[model samples]
Target: MMRVGVISDTHLRSYDRDLAKKLAEHFKDVQMILHAGDITELSVLDMLEAPQVIAVLGNMDGFAAAQSLPAKRELKLEGFQIGLIHGYGPPNGLEERVRREFDDVDAIVFGHSHKPTNYLLNGLLYFNPGSAAGGRGHPKTVGMLTLGDSISGEIIEI
Candidate 1:
């Protein structure tokens, strides 16, 4: 199985070093890390410390940034087609949006709600890791996905 650490919505002027260190230590065996978006800056990605990091650029990202991040990205992990985006607003019609963006996805991960969630629908697992840096009345946290030809995730509070 491949353990992947997931984080999102870190809009702070500075990242929490302690949290990063702890995550690095606890997820040392993880094969990769993913940041859903609203990162605001490239330094946020540097703090993750995971060898492999997959991320998306949210509305808050500046143009002409060096990171070459995409607004959406589809990745094949193990045997699953996973799609990612930084979803804001209500969940209604959100699935359609994702489907339109990545119709063949087997799983989808998103953020921008600042509320953690995980659900299965139409055989698709939709997940939101919440705000790892904490704000807007949301708990600060991250996530982990243990995958091998399949996918599942656990929300981890930062």
Candidate 2:
């Protein structure tokens, strides 16, 4: 299995030293990191030790690079198809959105609600790591996912 550090919504007003240190400790052995978006600054990605980082642009990500990031993406890990998106529709319909946007993926990961969640539907898993940066109205949160032959995940607060 491959361990993935899942982070999202870090809208930094200034450097976050505590967050950096916490990430280093929590994601120490993660093979990669995935940012589901709303990253207002570029430096957030720079602090990660993982060489492979995949990110999407959230509504609040105002940097130049963020504009170019696709609203959605797909990735294959350990023979599992994974999808990433920043959902904006009603939280109740989130499962349907994942099903509609990433029909072929075995799993989907997203952020924007600033609330961690996990669900299984149509033989696929959908995950939201919430606001890893605890930006403004959100509570600080982050999670780690393990990918392999079978799909399962957990949400963590840090």
Candidate 3:
């Protein structure tokens, strides 16, 4: 199985020591790391210990480090097509907006709501790892995606 660690909305200006420790402990076995955005600093990626890192630039990321990062991306992992987006506008219609943005994707990973979500809608998985920085009263969390014969995932609260 392929294990991918998913994180988002880490609005820290510098490396977060607690977050680094948590990642090292919990994501030791992950093959890849996905940052859904709002990562305020590019150094955050350098601090992670994953073999591969895939990310997008969120609305709040305006620095040079985030300048070249795409706003959206599509990747295939273990034969499943996954769409990555940082999201926009209000949270109420966020899912619909994402669905409209990508087609033929098995799963859509997004952030910006700072709320954890793991559910299937119209046969597509909608996952939001919440805010890894614990912003807006939401608990700090991340996600794990296991791909094998099929795709399965979980939102983990840190």
Candidate 4:
């Protein structure tokens, strides 16, 4: 199986040692890492130690971070098509907005609402790992996806 670690809305302007430690512990067995955005600084990405790292630029990202990353990304992993986006607007319509963005994806991973979600809708999986920095009154958390013959995921509190 391929294990993937998912995170978003870090919103840290600098490297966070505590976060780094938490990542190491939580994602120790993950083969890849996906950052959904609001990363704010490139240093945050640099601190991650994963075989592969995929990220998108969030609305709150600074010039450097924005310039270095795409606003959206489509990746094929373990026979599944996954769309990664930072998302936009209010939480209510966020899923509809993302659904319209990608035409042929098996799953969509996003963040912006600072809320965790893992649901299957019309045969598509909509996943949001919430805020790793605990924004919007939610507790800090991350996500994990195990892919093989079937795909399954879980939200892990940090």
Candidate 5:
């Protein structure tokens, strides 16, 4: 099985050692890491302890982060296709907006609402690990995806 770590909405202007340490512990076993966006700086990505790190540009990202990342991306892993994006607009209906961005994918990973969501709908897996930095009364969280015979997700409070 392949394991992947998912996180978003860090909103950090610089490196956060404490956050990094937490991520290192929570995501220690993952082979890849996905940052759904709102990462204000690129240094934040370095905290993840994974072989592969994929990320997108969120509305709140700074100029350098925006230039280094895409608004959306796709990946093919363990026979499943996955889409990653940083959602936009209001929290309500944020899933629908991100859903419209990709096609023929088994799952969509996104962040923007700072809400943790993991469920299967219409054969698609919609996952949001919430905000790792914690904001707006939401508890800090992250996510894990295990890919084998099928794909499954787990939201981890950090």
Candidate 6:
């Protein structure tokens, strides 16, 4: 099985020591890391201890982040296709909006609402790790995905 760590909405302007430490401890066993955006600065990605890091550009990202990352991504792991994106607009229809961004994917990982979501919908797993920076009155959080015979997600508060 392959384990993937998921985070989003860090919204940091520079490196944060406390956030980094929390990330390291939470994601230490994962093989890959996925940042769902609002990262704001590239230094946030440096905190991860995972071997592979995949990220997208959030609406709040800085120039360097926008230049280096895509607005959306599709990746396959352990025979499952996953879509990663920084969702836009309001939070109500966020799922439907992001769901249309890709096809034939087993899971969609996204953030924008700053809310933690982990559930199976129409046979697809939609995961949002909330705001790792704990902005907008939400609790600090992250997520984990275990990929083997099926894709599953768990939201972790940090």
Query: Model 2 over residues 41-128: C-alpha lDDT tens digits?
Result: 7667776668698888777777574656778899988898999988776667766665688768888899877878787866878788
C-alpha positional error of residue 6 in candidate 1 after TM-score superposition, expressed in Å:
0.8
lDDT of 5 by residue, 85-136 (tens): 9999998899999999998999999999999999999899999999998887
TM-scores for all candidates: the values are 0.87, 0.89, 0.96, 0.98, 0.98, 0.97
Local error of candidate 6 at residue 32 (angstroms): 0.2
**Which residue pairs show backbone clashes in model 4?**
none
Better of 3 and 6 by TM-score: 6
Candidate 6 has its poorest 10 consecutive residues by lDDT at 131-140
Give the runs in model 1 whose Cα sits over 4 Å from its true position.
64-67, 90-96
lDDT of 3: 0.89
What are the runs in model 4 whose C-alpha is more than 4 Å off? none
Query: Could you tell me the TM-score of candidate 6?
Result: 0.97
List candidate 2 stretches off by more than 4 Å: 135-138
How many Å off is the CA of 87 in candidate 5? 0.5
For residues 66-102, could you state the per-residue lDDT of candidate 3 as single tens digits? 6779999999999999999999999899989988889
**What C-alpha lDDT do the candidate models reach, one value each?**
0.78, 0.80, 0.89, 0.92, 0.93, 0.93
Model 6 ranges with Cα > 4 A deviation: none
lDDT of 1 by residue, 81-129 (tens): 8898887556576655665777888888888777787778788888888
Model 4, span 1-158: residue lDDT tens: 99999999999999889899999999999999999999999889976779999999999999998788999999999999999999999989999999999999989999999999999988899999999989688999999988898777789999
